[model samples]
Target: MADNAPAPPPLYDNTPTISEKEDPSALPPELAGPCSDQAQVTEEEGVASDIADKEELPLPPDPVETVTVTVMESQLLQKELPAQENPVAVEAEEPKLGEETELKQKQKLGQALQSLKEESNNVSDLTESDQKALLELKQLIEEALNEFSFSSPPEKEKNLAGTLAVEVSIWGIPLLKDDRSDVILLKFLRARDFKVKDAFTMFKNTSHWRKSFGIDLLIDEDLGDDLEKVVFMHEHDKEGHPVCYNVYGEFQNKELYEKTFGDDEKRAKFLRWRVQFLEKSIRKLDFSPGGVNTIFQVSDLKNSPGLGKHELRQATKQSLQVLQDNYPEFVAKQVFINVPWWYLAFYSVISPFLTQRTRSKFVFASPARSAETLFKYIPPERVPVQYGGLSVDPCDCNPEFTISDPATDMTIKPGTKQIVEIIIYEKCIIVWELRVVGWEVTCGAEFVPSTEGGYTVIINKAKKMTPADEPVVHGSFAVSELGKLLLTVDNPTLKKKKLLYRFKVKPLGD
Candidate 1:
């Protein structure tokens, strides 16, 4: 470490874990995330499953493949045949509920959302009514704090050796007297329609649950290391909310499924790991009234297991119950990618029953539309490569550029050619990283001089690249003369392809 360099943020010693830029690894902020996510596509919504290394499923099966969720689980799990018979999910139009179930589902869904407020960023801009509710809730919490009604967090010795704290806090903000406390309270209020008594009760329960669950100590516990890829906090979305990706498809593997849900003990451990990851991720939020106090949740369901896994289904129910009861409105939006056709049908039916604001927070994308749907809210470079983007996990590695190196993507029409040009005015070496997702095209590069009659130099000869080639192309060229670099892509196939590239000019040797 450099003598004058800022030390890595303290490892949550005296303070509660908190940071808008928290490192993804368990280590301090100086070190970042895991090498690779070990994630794969989820194809179960009605699309075909990866029958390729199909091992006999360890758990027994039920008659039908059903994807069902109570109001508490990731909304995407609500897709009610869930079979892949129609395969219309690949079409542009989404499915509405079955005619028979539409009206009935609507009323039930309405009841589910009847009390919750619409999703809003304007917690600071409260109405007179909202203000009154906020004040009432604060008083309730203050009184509880005064009386020490909430139990103290358990397992204090596990925390960094420090003095005990008298004040109770969630996500590091004190229950009273802190501006950010209002934001935390508002989440509970909005989750329960600003009903003070219900919000207060919910708050008490959360505090009690945290102590009983040993959340403070869980942060320091080493759950299954393999679970890291199942859910992880990575880069932020365009709006600055940290992005957490849930790849439940990992559970499809027999060994992993057994390890996570094989017995009651393993299931208990899995639940702890799930909650611990959420706590770690939540601590990274900025809870100030005006800060981004929420996260963007992306759950990839391509190969996610069906309901037949009774143990998993039961475990999921428990986890969702805990989240719905305690976590409240920390999720800004829940996006389910690679959704099967049935999920669309069910979501479309219930959407009308949800408040427009609440409905907006739930997004569903079919397999074909998954990558593009994610791109709408998260930049392609910030997206993981497994989902058809330029950003790689720490394992594949990005040597020439970091996330700060801006990159843009474009689509190439089938059977056409595209040329990209970059003008240079000084002596420098231009280095670039480029990738064509699922590439099967011919590409060439060259430089044209600015001076009249100056000769052009060919950088890379036009060569045919295939889907079997490396996912990204890294290149550089030295130019002592004023010139422009031209990179070309010729697509000979019938399908459109996405191209991403970025460059930076480096002066001659340091």
Candidate 2:
């Protein structure tokens, strides 16, 4: 010991040295180092005093000095001691009743902060294009608010666009990128003339309609030859937007159409056909740069005889109303070519039902000037020759025998049976229209299984037919099993009769 160092205190003054080793099991798990030492000293005081008296140690020189010496030695020993091996276990023990609520609060706060950090990370990970789009969208929203008082969105809807963008991005919806969020929102706003409430309503309705209508499924639907001939989508226009042609003149056979679709079931089919046609055209548009969002329509009225009839006009009006209500801002331009003088009267009757925005898209052209006007929007190389341009017509030009005509046609003598074999691999519909030319004959039709190696009748029916019968049969069947669909028709009559018929096979819901 150094000469200047203070004299050491007596070790046995009824105070024993706190054991450096403590029974860890006796102390609470949370107590460590100094706390455990203190507990050990207090608990074993009697044992230490007994040992000291037995040993007969001398008394301390001063009680205060003894206490000071003991405290200093304990602290120094604690500093020199190694760390405990199970500090985590001690910390993980259930907290005291007084600290339980505070511990729980801290844990909850940590969790909340972690969640906030994750959300911030997600927002920061947006691509450059997405970031640009969001900025543009915000700018547009602000512009709408400043320029049009009614266009300003309420607080509830202010974040709606942002929410929708995030959802679409997370879900990976096709054709709906985060970058196009502004374009979609602008469509609703424009449709409602910049009224936020109305725009939101339109947006909601469209979302519901998309779900109910199954537009995504419709994109894959295959339209039959009959519907395809009437409504066809061709090459792109000058602006790179797809062009659709509706040959209204070909629908001159009003009586035939009425007889073919007289029942409510067939009428429903007609409505679906119209909607699917529009959906198909919509699916063809590309949303990338230099691509247009709207379609160009050419309604050919050349040689239309019954378009002026009241029934035809009424049907046209209803069809237009449905299109306008369900699909807004879809048609960029609608050009009517070879418009007859009588057609104007029918147009006048239906034009009043159209919105000003819709009517502004109409462009009427006479037969002589149709090509000149169409050339402005469409290149001469892309227009069909029938419209006085260079491109060849992709469709059959025959008035009676259109693309819907059957693949095979034949004349069957009396007492002869003609078997028609159709091969299909999915749910489909088969339609046939037959007319007896010379005289009445007994016509028998049956559907027989072709794969079983033995004839098993699926449908067997025979009926007497006359020229006035005008028999047209339409039926649908599932083709789960891969096989041939056999249709056997028998003509059992003494006199020779000519059977002029047309049959079509098409996919269901097409």
Candidate 3:
């Protein structure tokens, strides 16, 4: 075998050996057989080949450009200097009187912000955007309180926040109650879009106005019987905000009003009555739950006898100015129902006096759509039946009566009068419907109050009716004094005029 191997090849022989030919199992166990080692090396090589094949994929493209940014030595030195400031100096300065006060104020403001944030979290009606705006408004209010001084020596006496604390009061009435300051400040801030100085100015002016205008007195003052009838607030809207009805129609007797409240004393009283109406509405909101701070107004103009006179317009302007300037965003919405073309023109003229935000709240609706539109914000049950709703509280006292008689042609001679009387034991509504047979005669109607001794004209002005006009003439008056409600019709023409009329009276139930 040695001779054959010697003859086979040099050291680097290319011939196949017996180790490569034999199976690994056929080799001896004890010896480090070349067959087993060769087999193991071959297996590993196969695995390495598979891995190499798998990893032979295309590589990604290189970046388009390479940029290196470096801070200047001076900038780096500036940053390092601040970081190495002596902590002792900072601590020593923080205890100074002014700085300490400022820190306390900041801490207080932080607490207020946190409180408002937590309060906002509990409110279910606010949208995400509203909540964010509210938070910003709260911050602005805190900033205003901290930067500016709202307290005077006198005002500090009434401060709910204490004598040493910052005073937050409007007209000497503390606005910074523990439970409601956040909300109160928010209203002012929101009105001015969080402009601190502007809101502060507005709030201060409002406080002065409230004091001079006797807003506190107005709250307790009785509006008297006459004004109570003119403005009604019996129901609430769908949002649980109170609804105020201003019967512009009932204010038709300009001449009578001029006569009744002509003097300065009476005029002042009248103005106070108007102011009291608003104050009463606000008081309702103040006492209401869930922070209701708005009112829904409805101005009914269906039977308004004439276009508002100059004096009436002036009075309205003054009243609206008071509400707009002082109350700010109190009226959430205002619907003008049965608005005639002339009234629309009047509104257009006066609209310039209104702020854009206030004008945006007004809605004019026709009779056909009045109930439908009102129902959107006011539930059907809350709305009165006269406006085409389901409420029966003050049942439609507008009962129709026919005065037509088949026996006689129901004609009234010239200079003749027809008087009908119905006794009302208590406060009630008197509605009437009248029609003239022909277009020739002018018909006039008036309401009179009867005493046991004599009768007096309650409605001094006689409303004129023509054949072309609506056959119905409806009105309501409160009969506070127990007496007969007398309805009178006069034919002022020379010729005999065929007349037809009907009237209904119903007690005003609470």
TM-scores for the candidates: 0.71, 0.41, 0.46
Comparison by TM-score, 1 against 2, better one: 1
Per-residue C-alpha lDDT of model 2 across residues 84-131, encoded as one tens digit per residue:
111011114478796698588658645633432211112246555544
Summing lDDT over every window of 10 consecutive residues in candidate 2, give the lowest-scoring window.
Answer: 1-10
**Rank list by TM-score:** 1, 3, 2
TM-score of 3: 0.46
* Candidate 3 lDDT over residue span 440-484, tens digit each: 333343444445665564653555666565533455565555555
Tell me the lDDT of model 2 at 25: 24
lDDT of 1 at 407: 65
What are the C-alpha RMSDs, in order, of all predicted structures?
A: 16.7, 44.1, 42.9
* Tens digits of per-residue lDDT for model 1, 53-134: 1332222221321111111121222232122122111224243464346456546545543433234445457888898998
Candidate 2 clash pair list? none
lDDT of each: 0.61, 0.42, 0.45
Q: Which lDDT value does model 1 have at 266?
A: 87
